[model samples]
Target chain A: MTDEGPLTPRVTGTVRIVGAGLLGASVGHALRARGADVVLEDASPSQLRLAIDYGAGRAATADDAPTLIVVAVPPDVVADVVERELRAFPDAVVTDVASVKLEPLRELVERGVNLTHYIGSHPLAGRERGGAISARADLFIGRPWVVCRDGKTPASDLALVEALALDLGATPIEMTPEDHDRSVALVSHVPQLVASLLAGQFADAPDGSLRLAGQGVRDTTRIAASAPELWVQILAANAAPVVDILDALSQDLAAVADALRAPEAVGARREVADTIRRGNEGVERLPGKHGQNRRFASLVVMVDDTAGQLGRLFGDLGALAVNVEDFRLEHSPGAPFGLAEIAVAPAVLRDAITGLEERGWKIASTTND
Target chain B: MTDEGPLTPRVTGTVRIVGAGLLGASVGHALRARGADVVLEDASPSQLRLAIDYGAGRAATADDAPTLIVVAVPPDVVADVVERELRAFPDAVVTDVASVKLEPLRELVERGVNLTHYIGSHPLAGRERGGAISARADLFIGRPWVVCRDGKTPASDLALVEALALDLGATPIEMTPEDHDRSVALVSHVPQLVASLLAGQFADAPDGSLRLAGQGVRDTTRIAASAPELWVQILAANAAPVVDILDALSQDLAAVADALRAPEAVGARREVADTIRRGNEGVERLPGKHGQNRRFASLVVMVDDTAGQLGRLFGDLGALAVNVEDFRLEHSPGAPFGLAEIAVAPAVLRDAITGLEERGWKIASTTND
Candidate 1:
């Protein structure tokens, strides 16, 4: 996600960021580019300096009375830092960008902290690694930045967070703290655990078995490579919701395994089929590029596995005025050619094939489904 | 995989193929293109006719004498079809392409069907849907063809199957029936089950949760869309081995769930960290595009979401002689630009970045790793 519109300032006033890690520095960078004043602080002096050197923002000064405060810290220390920030800047509207919403909010509430100016928000954006060095100005652009509001939250307070989201080119989605926690549990937390669990299966697998691995296992386990230290905190902080989803997943897994173990038993195969069909339906629910996705028709064309061969094909598509909705390159082991699977709107599929054929391209699949 | 080298047929004399499903018709198509005489048969007359009309092969006749027969029936009836084919052409070296090998081999042995001539093989190749309508002549190209052998099997009989694999542009790897079934169980069967189970969780999930779904969930569940009817038979045939792996996975899942449920417990976070680390190691074992893959350095460049922008980038790369090893297009919702994450060799990354920058392309990620 990148900021594409005119780079004019939208957010006003001096903003103080309490951490200078990936998320913190990214927020500073985005706001700084919008011509707003950003003051950065961090427990690590080197980190704060590194972000300043990178032109994300200036170092914090004691005399600076910030109008806004963004607390971007690790999940374990989030509530502690948010509590300190609220007390330090009583009049400033405070927001924290932590993965989980309810735990920190609940912690702040139990501690009897005045959270009238505090808002819990999460921007669903990250890279594989995190650091001030890895921060980007456009990291949150075009991503969903969830803004959590409670009954006590003022309309003016919510507007400030929304403006920050929009200034970074992120879509601001309104959700309650409880709903936000549960939603992320289902979407992010549980999926991380599942991927890690599935990938662990391969650790002990024979090399021969691994040699046979295909795109399926690779895709299912790709996210398992995220840092364990970071995930341990996220999972622990959001334990209840994550556990709820994991328990449900465990039950489904057990039933399917039991059915496979006794295939001849009545309705055993039926149970397995239903579970798989449920997965098919589940995947269809994901929103596509434009909206709730209507699958685009795909065509697999063969391209010579050289530098310029793909360029020739894509250049031809550009010439044909065919907008490729999605595309993936499939390189076969020890093969001279690679398959380019391009998805397009069905209306243009026939013309795309016709045009490519006219250009002497070899179409390997005419399945059209 | 395309037949890039030559059009010469390696296997001599008339070849008979039983079953006109995807694999059967594809074999016919590849063999016919090599100027080899092929006779096709299926239990259903209409199916056989469709294969012939598609130019896969001519229909079988009673007078036809075959030197080799390929049994490409479903796993459930593999032994029956192989037994029939063996009786019809006793002198011919026969092979059957079935997903599970041990069961069919044991069945054929139990029924006293064959003492010689039959070879059990499986080509690690398939599309989302099956049928002659989806068959391609190059379907077997660049894929692994697992050939199972026994002490009693003759060298000449094994040679025939290997030759067929080579002719179809596949790499033949010799494996025992036990090894083949167990290997496929680890890489293919268990993975399919995990994907199905994970996907099933989303079937009842809230739309708000699914809207927050990202690429990790999308990749992990993509294979959940496979045909459940076919998987039921395959999973049933390999029940014992699949259940063994699933049970192991269940234990891991339970341990992590228990740990997450009570984060304050001793060794709680350790248990979660270990599972995730194991997955990290497991995914690393997967082979890359090149032999035992060394990761290619990647650069994420922003492109306009409209048509032809990618063509320009690739064309520039081609001109600069920077071979793009791999690429994926990242489209954002309601954003004017997309990101092209291109993987190239580390040696070329510096030059590639410089050249692209000179060409006025905005490189989003400077993190080389």
Candidate 2:
């Protein structure tokens, strides 16, 4: 929810977005699609024309007094761009969308820049690629738009930022700069670093080691494809928080390794179990959809290799109106046999189990009692 | 390759598969697909008919003189069935496809029987559902079929087993039972545990935190949907190896945790970086086919929120006659702008990057160097 009280009028004006890159152009395009006037500016004349030609905005010069100015530039240059815009148009309420918050906020404060109207925001949506030509009006839809509002953020300016997020079809989340940085460090930064480190191991693999690699390792490290330079900057900025999470993960990994080397030691085995158990406990703490905890139920069915059998089973479930949450099969060795584990609602387990057994299906389970 | 000599005359005959469940029926189905004489035997008359109706196999009674007997049964009773088959059809070659070979193999050896004609095999393949009704002939295709051949496996028996893999269109990989268990522990078993641990974290999350999960967490923990009992048995049988890998992971995690708790220490940060970096290195070693590890050379272009820009970009690339491997977009704030990363082959990267830039597009990087 926006910080402003209810019944406050949202400012409706020609929202002008400078830079016309991915975020800039996407904002203009979304605003325009929603029947709002959008004007765009960029230092590159080619980018300016492309934004206009692409229908991202109506072409506008720097002289226009836009009520709101969005500075979408590179991380290294965001502070400079924001300062320049302030000098260029002092009347506008300015904001910047840089990934790291503390650095830019520090830069503005250190320079003694007037801060009453500036807010720091980051829309947590991205892809592996970048640029203005890649911008889409629907890009931010359903994503979190984090507004790092400080004490200096005026009531009017905060509402304008929130309105911009809502206009772009994003969920606006208000967070302190430190909280935002720490959370992202734990979630985004750490994952990237982990992937990069995993990928880096392959740089010195033997001839066939890589070719023989499989899906497990691939899934675990797919995020390694991120840009090196951008990550370097992000990691450098959020180093403190990210390092903390990494330390936790590393300690856990070391203990696991030591336990494997000495399985006979009961102490080590218990530690192994404890770590696994802790991971279990931690995973359970994660939120569910719309912010709720989801309960996952499971069922195991014995199956054979034959046609129409699966169809019949699913058809039977459909007949009984038992909704399967999910299902998995593990093929047993020695002959044509396997086990199928089906997940369903806890409320329906008894009926579903009985329904299958009554139909002559061998449901393999230890009695509940 | 089969164990038989380069030009040994191929011997093919009727093979009877008992049980007709996922594994049993898949054996029959795969053999049948390769034009083998597949005869199926099952206690479940309905399942027998289902297998026949699905064209998995021709029906066979208890008295057939089968060239091979494939006992696809549960681990708990693998010995009983293997011994029963041996007493019934002493001359026929016998094999069991149990996940764990040592226990079943030991059971057979303990029966004081001449096991010269018997071999053990395990094919790693499956889905999240089961039964003869769920069987597919192509289920084992392209999957690793480990043939456990050792001191007890007769030369003739090895040839027969290798021929079986060929008939089923499976890639036969020969490894000592111990090595096979270790490799799977590193690749499959440990991965399952990790995924489950990750998934379990979501069980207790507040509604808000759960809603924040994206595709990253989904893909990373997808294997969590596996059968619990089957995994229990798998991990139990390969406990030593899995424990070894987990121990390694735990050690790394612990070190990381320590670093997180004490970020002010230089050694802590460096150690954390190393662990994260190691994960990145390991990630690159993974193979990519369906989520494989193949690298795509990319061209990043800056674009705006304009109608038809994406279409034109794609059209221009198509016109360049270079295959675009993949594409992603990063939208920025302030302006509706973004950077588009387009993946192509290294061979095509130069042409594509130059071609786009020549057309007056803002490219992120034009050269790899």
Candidate 3:
């Protein structure tokens, strides 16, 4: 095993993973791939065997003494597992990978667990499915792993958790548990509920109405297909923050509905337009792939729906040495052609359009940044 | 120009396109490409000239008579344009391609305009940007073009409009004006409002909250960037139906908020889970690319983020003679590796896994269909 990247943080001793599900098994796989000692444990014997068989880690034994213990379990059981792990391994730094943070910390506080060696962390990485079989060594690569630390957390313990995140090719962001919960409630939890509710509207829709569904509805509702049982726990665990956001959203929705109901009334059109414009500004505030608010100029290029069309376009882009910041392909059902919307830095937009057009590709339009 | 597909509907004689905007110019281009005479007109001289220069069609002449007239204008101006086109060419079958069908039809009825030669159609196709510059010849190809025809409409006029949709590579589905409006309200208009309102929540979010935005929020709010002015017109034009859907959605959202606010209460968790499960079922009812609800099995293959990794994967799949039904690539920022989720027919899932694994590729997991 080779630990070859500059981002790989070094850990000297054994790192034990509890609850060998997707996140736990993945942490083990990633750590084992980096030539680190890893011990795996799970309440279910079958899951532990599967993780070990998959080369994630070896089975934990009483003789083994771990330096770090990562609690990766469902949100409902996270606090219990963390408490038990901290009690069993007094010398080990205890952390968790649960989606929710504050609830577990409060639980530990209420139970009067020692705070000296516990640091809560959440690696913002996952797959649609769960289990050891779905685990991968690179699951955390380039993802954000948030570490929750308070004034009471020991500096050494926090550093150890951050190192674990770095060793797994993740960027560790320090945040308070309250801040973590609020941030995720806005970005992750609220979006899930919105998608679910929007998709639920489709349940009683006329059959032909759904036949008119296009890419807009599909993209908006894609996450609605997530595991409902799992989401129920995540949402309930962070209910206060999520509810706060949803209540605000409900008020805004009511305002929009009122305006639409009386569109011919004075100021109704302006109200509706103002809400939409705010949405435009809100989306603009979102960071791009590089975690920056920098915008990229995009161009739509028309291409026939042939096998080599996209490959040829990418080849041409390579020949021009123009890096495509992002790409999305749009094809209508039954159309013989599709459009490739490619994003590039503003400086290279003109060059890309000229080069591609000179190479006989039709440039449909250059969209505003 | 070659028309070489089973879906290519044939039409003869001159076709007049009023309003040289995106849809209008695209219709002209598609018809002109099929060796038909197309005349373009717009209130804006500059836009008309641009569309003509872009090979959409030639400028309309006073002496020339058209067999068919297509009114492609904004929702607010659609009725006026359709009425003018009907009077200008009494012998021609007239159709308007506004997104909302019933409003314009109602306006025409209120004015008591001659309805013998008029039909309302809306092609479910568009790019983010508008105007002649964004138009493409294949924009409507493979998309659903809805034609609203009543009992009073002449069969020949309705057939002409359907032929026009088919000739432009679209599938024409006959619906009443009321049905068309209601369907678009549920599928298109309501989704737009939901996305806009959800994104609006970000306007006043805390400074660091949006930094954690993931693909889910991005997908749910993608369409919120649409032009506010244009959407105001569309929402107001179909205000009745859209308001109806929004009202129902608002009620459901309120219920969800109430449940999330008190998750520990009896049945609160069950209510939240039930709502999410209903969303899953709703999404499952949406047809796939080929207009079927057949679910495809998926396999996740790990790949480094080096250039040509996706190309190589496709090449290998081609060599194995396995058809990829759909695919999605997911990567985190600064990650050195990514996962390619490839979908294929259920019958070939095992073979694909074995073939790729033998070729030295890592198959992470096979997702349930």
Candidate 4:
């Protein structure tokens, strides 16, 4: 089925979602929104009922044969579910949305499952909470959805999975299961561990120290609030790769500690400075908005904490026809004012500033300075 | 001198700023905006002239004997400047805005310089760049301006420093030099090191791994982009406390690495889960906006990439009379749409959602589900 809209991707055939958790329910929602027929299944009857009630999809029946089967279960049971779905739906191309790919693929391979029709995919989008109630139709929109396929997999099967990702407004990236696991370990898993451990240090902090916490600490430790139970499964499933990255990070942390301890020694300060400088280079390597390498110039505009101040600023920008590439609002603790940092294209920076100034909004700094 | 405005703090004497860098220039601008007679001084002639041209203050003269002196110089030279200022203007209540407090106090004590008129303050406000050109008059507004006092400091001197902070629209927080140093070490200094080291890991990551980097990694390493040269000085001056925190962090990292390496071992998974769980509790201890433990409910509103979409949303919010306590905009890597997470008082969440939905905006999820 295809929906008639520029925003909707043309996806055909019936899609079966075999879990009613966050990822599965979200996939079903997105697909159903685009007029694709979706079938929902879950081991828990309540979850299945909730997904259906939430309009993700209708209950699946034995007579229904789907064109594609998406297995969205936990990592520990991904292999088992994928195997069962493949055996049950021999005519359907099967895919699983498990965070870690290599282990499950290995397990399926060891179990002698025919994997020609199976592909492993991971949509790198999630919220803090799970379950069907929290699922949204746009959960995967604009996110990176990794599709893992071996050389033996048929092109038609790969195309079907890619179409699904595209229809859901995600970018489909092709990678081997091994590469996918390693990439996530470096980018996601290791960072989560670092944030958690860093935040863990706060437990022993002196009484008043936390009261002094600022945006720096808040941002650094934000992900530490993630569910421990979910992370345990993710970390354990991708233990080998995650552990390797953690080992490297530990060595670096040790070096930083040594350097800080004896900063007066020759070369110690340089070592500390070098690590921080390398970090600068590393962060710059990450792509900017819209997955592009282009950078935008930022200007800070001052606003009062009063309700309509931000609205007025944005309205002024709209009148000036300045497109804000990005925006961040910074409010100091106990302060009744805020600074809105607006990111705009370099070409429009001067015009945007002059326009805002003409509108009586104070420009703090055209450059971070 | 007093400005005829309710927002202006009542101060009736001349204020002199010694350094024409970001902090120094900002102080001059704020005091001048409040109609205080201000004199600016700087080692760099260009910076001083820039501050003067920016309407921060006039150039300092030998005849200018200000009642209050703010020494806003680099950490390495803060003590020297503070001592010189006290000697130059014996009657002036002297204060220095340096990140580290204990070192400067110690240096003055060792030199036998009486600090009866001197108070150390550090405004917990800064941007990535530093210069007179980047200064903002309202930089310290609503931020914590920590005033470090000792027994020898007279009540009048303490009151003068606090008055300066208040006049500049900052909240004055009093703490002993030792306590202030320790508090900042826990909240700011150590988080900086952790972020830098964590970002350092990305330097050698396999190509394309960073393309998968999400907000979690971005925030965890955001502070790593700060100037290494500046951090080197801050970290060095506060070496002892920062090193202590780093040592503890190192031990934790080692334990996490060990746990991840053998996740299937007895209690290994539990250990991992425990560390992350502790992180949750630690982050929970941090006060939210307004420096209160109260939590705000968040709802995500979807907006298209078209110009004026955000403006329309904000305008709608204003029309509905909803007070947004905090806001965060999340855009996908390659998506043309963005999610605006608006934090509102819990009492108004239902009304806000209903109002926005009535206005035709798509509600992604109310609870980050």
Candidate 5:
């Protein structure tokens, strides 16, 4: 089981994945694809056998000792299964892929298990779907694989977890368990609740009101389709941070509500405007293309319905040695008029705008608004 | 004079759209597409010529009289423009396509303009781009066109406006000007603020934080890239209602936040859970598939790496006469598993689930989640 220079790396010892569910099977598929020996374990023999039959892993007997153990199960059962697996494999580096990190990390430590080999990890990739048979080798590719490195995590444990993440074609992001939970609470948990609440409005609306819904309502409530049980666990675990953000949001909403009741109050309108303005400020701070947190350049062009006019406009921009980031088109009926909005980098904004204007294009100016 | 048959209606003159901007052009386009005679007027000769050239209308001369006049201009200028257009065309039934209604309506009435020929309408449709060239005839199709029929609006004026909306292929939604503003504040204005605030957080995020973003961040902040000035005007105009919604949200957020800061505090966690649970309840209320407020049935099936297993599974379901509304696949790492989430009509859920399980497929229980 060895290799030298110019030879392929020897197949590593099997990495045992308990549960053989979505996360567990994904790990096996990824590891197996990378020439690592993978072993799958599941209480459901049918599920386990399917994983083996699919070449996700070799069938693991009770006596098999693997190099690593990845615990992938429901959040409530993660602690119990992780502890059992740790006991089953005293030497392997054990990690659990759970959404909430700190609670599980603390629970394992409190249980007085061997902490040196345990590393907490969460790969932030998921779909509305669930379970082992859904596992894909490339599922984690290009996604962030968060590795929680704490005092209890040994150097070998960190290295092995990092290696595992790398092997699965994931980017290893080092974060504290607490930080991970807080970040996710703000970005994921709170948003999900917001989306759900917004969508829920339709449930109580009269039939007539529901029929009036357009694309805006649809887009705002898209994430409401998430699994309720899974989301409940996520929200519960990240309760504190999510509540903090919501509180701030609540204060903003309260101010807005007051303004609506009596708009003539001088400062009332400003107060409401301020909250919306703050929202505006907050939204602009989000990252853009390929993770660049830069302002988008908007180009407004007026066109007609000559077939291929849009394609020609886009083609012309491409020929001008300018990169078109993103564009949206607006057409007015009977007017045979079209407005095309194009997003570009900030550095190129002025040049692109001026260039388009020079080409006989009518660019909408924000200053005029 | 126009000829008319028993089946063919009497001659109706053009619906004159003033300003020939994005909104006006869109109105023109929609009307023209629906076989309505349209003519547009703009103070700027270049814009007026452009509107005519773009086929928004056959050139509208100052001497021309129309059956309807649509005033489409900026919010601040709406009242003055509507008044001027009313004075200009005494015989035409008039409507101003403005976002904020009460202010403009009050301003026009106070000026002692002829009230019998005028109504206020707002078609809720737009794109990021603007101006006459951006107009598309189909812009208002299937969208809610609110007719603000106040006590002063003549019955004839209201009827003509509703007829115009029908010709433009828009769903006529009747509401008072005040109610329209308030409703929009909750649905449209406040959401813009929320999206903006979320995006603003990334405005100064550290490089590392920026790199860690995923699809969630992208989606939540998509609307943040809107026109700043246009939003400013909208917020300023409807500050009262937006403030009201924001204030209400703030109160809820504060209660949740207090719960988070003291997780061990007895009722704190419960309150947070309750709020989240309410959010869950709310999200489910949203209309699903073709305007029905029914929960779609979901079946989660475990899958493996067998070639064409998914294709065959879908085929098998099809063969079983199951109509799958929607489906998504997610792979679980380490588990060598894949989970497929399939949506169907509620009545078909149990049957589909049983069929899949009977075929040796391990389907997770829906109730468990």
Candidate 6:
């Protein structure tokens, strides 16, 4: 919807979103914005009415025959819903937005459902909370939408899903179901487990030590606050791939623990060093803002803990023509000021420093000056 | 230095800092700003000269008699340096800013050295990099500086260390050396190892999967980019406590992995749910900004990817008299705009949304509306 030139959505015919949760309502809102007709359905009548009232779409009717069917249910019931939709709308191109792709696809295939009308798709976008009330039309904008396909997947069926992604302002990525599951297992599922396991260590921590918690542990365990109800289903459905990654991680953890236990022994220190070094390399592989793999030069400035101080600081940056690549605000307990870490291009680091300093800002640190 | 009520420093006499690294140079700068005489020393000549050149302090001289000694060295050499500093300045009170305290304290006690004038203290403050060049005078401001003591410690000697902490604008926390080590092991050391061990799993991950990484994994693995040399030493020094936590974590991880592997088994799903639920509870224990254990309401607004857009948005908030508690900017791949998630007090959430919407900002989502 942010794009004005394209009033015509790529998706055509009547689009149906089944399940009025965050993703379903969001999809309905997006398709509706694109001048496409959308019908909504949910197992819960109250949820369906809520999405409809939010202007996402209208309630589905018995005569409604959708050209595209988006199955937006939980992972546990994805295959069952997809099967029902495929049978109900025999000619419609059916796709799903479940986090894990393979298990549902395999289950549908096992149920001997018709293969011509089904494709698996997932949009790598979400909010902390779920429900129709939290839906946003622009949620998928700029996010990746993976379309899972195989040799038997018809081009026309795949095209409908890709068109949905495009109309919703998402980048369409073509991947096999196996690849999708494996990739998410590595990037998403296992990391959730790791964060949870790490946060769980805080159970026995005394108040004195917990008081010393810094930004490092906070960032490392931030995802541990996710809802367990949703995670249990996601992890259970992708158990094979998740287990593979966790088993490997458990071994590495045990090795590091053993090395730390006898650090003065031959190669013990080396083993510990190797693990952290490998981590440094692994983290380096992640792309930065806007899908670029380049690093940003970071500088920290001290700001008084008062209202409108950040506004004035950012206003000065804008007036100085400095583009902030990324920003984070760090506050110490009982400190009268906060440290605002601004990331910018390496070439503009000097200008940002000179301009902010001239504007009466205190520069705490700059990286690789 | 940000506080200008008085020029006289609480810390008295010629304070000698024996390491010219980040902590040492920062301590020197802060004390110098407070009009305290400081003498500097380092094993490396260039490092010592660099600290002096950076306006930290004058180099140590043969006749330099210090009333206080701060041993700011690495963890492995902490005891050795502390022993020498205590012996060299027999009349002066000595302290070291080592990350781990129990091992060095035990080693010094085992050496049968006089412990009356020595204290183990650590300021929980640091930058990602080390050395004099990256040091800042306000490093310890608003941070917790732990002072380790036992029954034999004198009140006068403890007062000197506490005054030093007050001079640097850090809160003085009293704890036993055993408690300090165990606390950091739970909060800092274990989290570091967990990040490293989890990031190490990316060795065999395909690039496609890595590209699918979202903010969840990015935050969870952020600290994995830390320098390995420092962590190896910290982990090694705090081995016993760290191993205890890791052992417990290893057991929990093994249980979750086993549960996921056979999710259909009795109570298997419950096991997985319990781990994440425990994480939820543990993360909830961390203190929020300014040491308050409170939650903030979050709302997301769409901002066009342009210079000064953020400035404009924040300016609007400031003009509307809305104070932002926390903010994060998330951009999607190939998206023309970014989502700005602003966290504010729940009472002011309605005002923020209404004001932003009236100013032509697109409201993407709101919490618990």
State the TM-score of the second chain for every model: 0.97, 0.79, 0.95, 0.95, 0.78, 0.97
Q: Pick the candidate with the highest lDDT.
A: 6
Pairs clashing within candidate 4: A335-B142, A369-B129, A369-B130
**lDDT (Cα, tens digit) per residue for candidate 5, span B1-369:** 011123221225778888888888877766765567888878788887877888887777776878888998888788898888788888888888888888777787788877677788888887767878777765665467889876767777788889877776566889878878876765667666666655554454454544556555556556765766567567767766666666655556666567666756788656755665665565555444444554666777766533345545665576566765544454332233456666667777888888777777766434212
Between candidates 2 and 4, the DockQ winner: 4
**Candidate 1 per-residue C-alpha lDDT over A38-146 given as tens digits, one digit per residue, 9 for 90 to 100:** 9999999999999999988998888988888999999999999999989988989999999999999989989999999999999988888798999998888778889
| Residue B198 in candidate 6, Cα distance off native in Å | 1.1
Candidates in descending lDDT order: 6, 1, 4, 3, 5, 2
Cα-based lDDT at residue A144, candidate 6: 94
Candidate 4 lands at a TM-score of 0.96
lDDT tens digits by residue: candidate 2, A87-131: 777777888877778878888889998877788898877655566
Highest TM-score, which number?
6
Per-residue error at B230 for model 1, in Å? 0.8
Question: For model 1, what is the error of residue A34's alpha carbon versus the real structure, in angstroms, after optimal superposition?
Answer: 1.5
The better-scoring model by TM-score among 4 and 5 is 4
lDDT of every model, 2 decimals: 0.86, 0.66, 0.84, 0.86, 0.67, 0.88
Error of 1 at B351 (Å): 1.7
Docking quality tier of candidate 3? medium
Using DockQ as the yardstick, the better of models 1 and 5 is 1
Please write out the lDDT profile of model 3 over residues B91-143, one tens digit for every residue. 99888998999889889999999988888899998888889988888778778
Among these predicted structures, which one has the highest DockQ?
6
Candidate 3 vs candidate 5: which has greater TM-score? 3
For model 6, the stretches where C-alpha displacement exceeds 4 angstroms are A1-4, B1-4
Please estimate how well model 5 matches the true structure, expressed as its whole-model Cα lDDT.
0.67
Better of 1 and 6 by lDDT: 6
